[model samples]
Target: MPNFPNIILFAIPFFILAMLVELFVTAKQHIKSYEMKDSFSSLTMGLGNVLLGFVSKALVLWAFLYVYDHFRLATIPIIWWSFVLIFFADDISYYWFHRVSHTCRLFWASHVVHHSSKHYNLSTALRQTWSGSFYSFIFWIWMPLLGFHPAMIMLQMSISLLYQFWIHTETIDKMPKWFEAIMNTPSHHRVHHGSNPLYLDRNHAGILIIWDKIFGTFQLELKDEKVVYGLVKNINTFNPIKIAFIEWIYLFKDVLTGKKSIKNRILYLIKPPGWSHDGTGKISNDLRNEWLIKKKTYDTK
Candidate 1:
């Protein structure tokens, strides 16, 4: 079983190369985007993630090892087949992790960094969360406890994450029907990143599309409607600190200001990102209206 560091070392180069290819393609298509604004923030957040992975993943692996040692579960030899199973299992775990990350205030604080970019490109893929490893790892710990080795779990997670990187692009409009139906493709991911009403919280598949379909969170991209990327109330600031913690701060502020009961306060945190106390301004609806009006004008053109 390869260590997490080794897996990262092998994957980072591939990721970089793939991102470069995506950038070249995006440039050729004349897409307007930003890859380097607040780069230091991305670097710092990435460094923080490395540290968190070391501490949290180590502890989780230790706990899993303890359980495995105590139960004396038959140690399966690492093989190609095990890798395939681990890949699928890791993806399944990620689907839940991502869904919860959006739904939970504590997790959303970390997850919001990735969505801060209004432009969806390969660079957006590198705009990762600094604090996501904390809550996100819980979803995958079950894999190791269920008898898969910690190293195998980590490898599968790495591969699954690597596979998702390509799906962050707008360059590839869609894939073959069967591939798009089974796997998370660029079209599916674009919807996930879109702020459009129909796209909100949709297509949360990690590797397989089945989870989103089964859970009824799946949404197809409408050709007539263009995607407006980023959050409802866009975080205009470039500060990574604000980008990461803004929602958490806002959630706390909402709880403090509102006369709502504890249940409602809790709901504010767990509800979709733009759900307001008075229901005055819904980002999803505003975006939907904006999209509809734009579509109307384009049709006239």
Candidate 2:
């Protein structure tokens, strides 16, 4: 993939320019969207992510190529139609990768950094994961093994990442309903960032929103309930290291000293986030199910 991070580096200037334009337009329209500190923190996270990608991306490429070299089932050719096929294939890989990131605490430790930001804007999209590059690529190993070249897989992954950049915004509320139905829009992404009971882990699409619909993880943005951004328990620090690695630290701490058996302690890493042996922390589905019952009872009352 010719060092895809270097390829994305070319887009950095354009990304900044787009963010500036968004900021300017929102300011002119009298919208209260970007906060100075939060935006700066998001930028720091982006910078860290890009820098970390330089070292970690090679491992992903190496693993994918190794699989393609030895174990490819069928040689998928690189062509125009191949890109179309891989587009959906790659997006399906992304859908499951993103879904697992939400459900499994091991991955969520890295994935949660992206959600640490309280503000959702162009900059928030840049607030990606420093550690995500390490583990998330495991989900795509099957693509290369299925006969897709590592280079092609990397290309599609980068394309999906690029496609997702613009969707992290509050300025463009909803695209045409049809567009929103098929593609991931800012509206869909905003819900992914939301901490609300109904919205938590609801929209995990990378490029196409169809995966979420098919997988039953999709949630519509309701006019009655405005989306509230950030995690239910917000990490109020802007320190990049804390934002990026705090979850890892917490995960280890729980596993090491939570007064549980060795099996349950180890399970802390494998189980869903907020899972507790003592019945304290709640998973996203648990919270959403409770919210639905309450809403139903209130309506009938």
> 126-205 in candidate 2: lDDT tens per residue?
89898889888988988988989888888788888888999987789889989999999998888889999999988899
Ten residues in sequence with the least summed lDDT for candidate 1: 38-47
TM-score of each: 0.82, 0.96
Candidate topping lDDT: 2
lDDT per residue, candidate 1, 221-289, as tens digits? Answer: 989658888886688876767776777778789877758888878777777666666777454446656
Give the number of the best model, judged by TM-score: 2
Q: How many pairs of residues collide in each model?
A: 0, 0
Error of 2 at 68 (Å): 1.0
* Candidate 2 stretches greater than 4 Å from native: 1-6
TM-score of decoy 2? 0.96
Off by over 4 Å in 1: 1-5, 38-44, 70-77, 256-269, 276-301
The models' CA-based lDDT, in order, is: 0.75, 0.89
